[model samples]
Target: MSPDIRDEAVEMWFGPQHVSAHGWAAKLTVVGDFIVECDPHAGYFHRSAEKVLEFRTFKQGPLVLERMCMLEAFLAEYPYISAVEQIAGVEVPERAKVLRTIMMEASRIHSLQFWWGQFSAELGLFAMTLWPWVDREFFLDTFEELTGSRHAVSFSTPGGVRYDFNEKVLKKLDRALQRLEQHLPKFKDMLLRSPTFRMRTKGIALFSYEDALRWGLSGPNIKACGVPMDLRKDWPDLNLAYDLVDWEVPVVDNPDHPGQSDAYDRMVQRFLEVETSINIIRQLLPQIPEGPIVDPKARAKTNRLPAGEAYGRVEGTRGVTTVWLKTTEKAQTPYRAKIRGPCFASYYSLKHLVPGSTFADFIVVFGSLDPYPGWWDR
Candidate 1:
């Protein structure tokens, strides 16, 4: 409590060891455990992914870039593939369109499952992490069986999904969804009754509706703040006309608890979204039409996009991720390409959240926000 000690600079090695440190070592500057500053010493697992993409063929980059974030493979690839397809002027098949919608929802569920689990872990609740991961694994297995890879399927291509499905695959997806429906209520009860979890997060790390809007927060962050701007329902053009599918955007009324966009509300909103994603998958599966996976037999093993500039974006696992491609008129390689990740906005908000809070609260707030650094560092 002495003023001299308080004013003295102190540095600490906070974590390269924590489970939620996002696979990097962080050297945090602490004014006695309050984390006045943080320097993220990134690249503990860096593979020079962005640079490597240039060496790979256009078709090959999809697989390589998908690995940029293990939890967000779909969102990462969707934009890339969409951009390539746009430059090539290829029309995606209707069956492929429906499949992309279903796959995207499944991927969204996978990432949110991880986020929900981590949110509970941050609150010191272990069961919440366990149950949802176990349930989500079923979908992972389904993706693996369908696409030949679980985490980074590389299933999507410029024009359509790389593969098609059969009746049996649909049946399997239906069964897994049925299990999710059955167990979700139990998961809800566990979170609802956990007094400590509720107390720790209920009103902490609050963000107002204005704060969310000002910061350009989307997905569950917006939903948690009592806004109903779901990309699937509200902005269908983003997904190449995914509106034909029937689904509801879940919304909440928290005017009494106005500006109640705290860690608790964020977690609760994700839980609700997990349910909505499951419903979307269930509804989309049976209605999926029978058709060829890809038609016209793509021009070459590797696609050469036309020389021009195009930016494609998709509502990803975290929020909105965009890809900008500029091609030289004749060259097979891209002249320039850019990836815009969603986590940057969420991470930037830490400046606003951390100053007045204690260190443990910092971890709780960061984990609840679920800013995946692998995507950001890329």
Candidate 2:
């Protein structure tokens, strides 16, 4: 509206249709070809999950939380369930612990595949997206066979998991792990060898070691920045057999790149992480001790936790998802429940990152980070 504004600096809308946009569009003010500012508008799929949870029984809250991040539903549910169990002082059965770990790993790969493949697609490399999706579907197929749902699995409950795993699910899991292992190299080669991907992403985002820590980035985003901090390893309440698995966290802060944490590095970091995750799954499956998937006596309903406050944090696909719960001694519902989603932190960084970059590059960076907008808007 001002004479000082560049003629090309009109606001452009990246509508909800784009894959990376995650069904939420932005009103971006552009000057020439660079995005000067972005009004990120979400609520496209706002279900008001927290408000809805108040109405459901305590045992039914996991279903509400799982939808918070459909891609990483199990990971999202873990902290919430853990909070409930801790508040109620419920000791989960050993079999349920192993099943929870297995489900967590499966969800991690499932969500990473989406991030890795979408990164390629956002860069206009169709094959990178297609191959990984095809490969990822193999894993989803296992989830479906096991839980009877591919995504938005409400398999988890407050006391323990809602159902049990039979020999059939175990067999399916074994096959899925093998397929994922076989496909990992192909995914890596497809992303790593692409010159376009490398050129576009390399040395772009540039969040330094201190900056990453300052911003409180986590998961692959932090691990990619040469930090070995993983909540699963840092906090052992997860009851994971991480020590049994031989894998390394991929940390790459190339001096040559010189504080440049670009889209390429972010992508390559995921490539490395995916390989690590696959290797971990391989060792975990064969070593999976004979046990029930859930506590045989655990009730599917009417499992009320203690009356107290408890917090649970887990390394979700995007980052740390922390669930806080407050319970009343004689009540069957939580007095208060809150979620600190990692994507919410990443979304704030966008205000700093989006400007000065082309709209397309903004999309590239956004996709590479793979923030689950649903987690934030919910």
* Cα lDDT computed for each candidate against the true fold: 0.73, 0.74
Model 1, C-alpha of 314: deviation from truth (Å) = 1.2
Clash pairs detected, candidate 1: none
Candidate 1 TM-score, C-alpha based: 0.90
Candidate 2 lDDT over residue span 59-146, tens digit each: 7788888888888888888887777666655566666666777788888988998877677777888887787788778778778877
Q: After superposition, which runs of candidate 2 have C-alpha atoms over 4 Å from their true positions?
A: 1-8, 17-20, 238-247, 258-260, 296-302
Tell me, by TM-score, which candidate is best: 2
lDDT of 1 by residue, 1-378 (tens): 356655764777656677667475556556765766655565666677666666666677688668877786866788877777777767767788888888778788888877778778777788888888987888888787788888878878776778777666676677668788898788878886688877887767788778877777776776788887765665455435366666677766566587558887777787788888887776776777778666554535236666777777887767777778777665577677787777767766776666556677778877767787776667
Best by lDDT: 2
How many steric clashes between backbone atoms does each model show? Answer: 0, 6
Cα error, candidate 2, residue 94 (Å)? 1.7
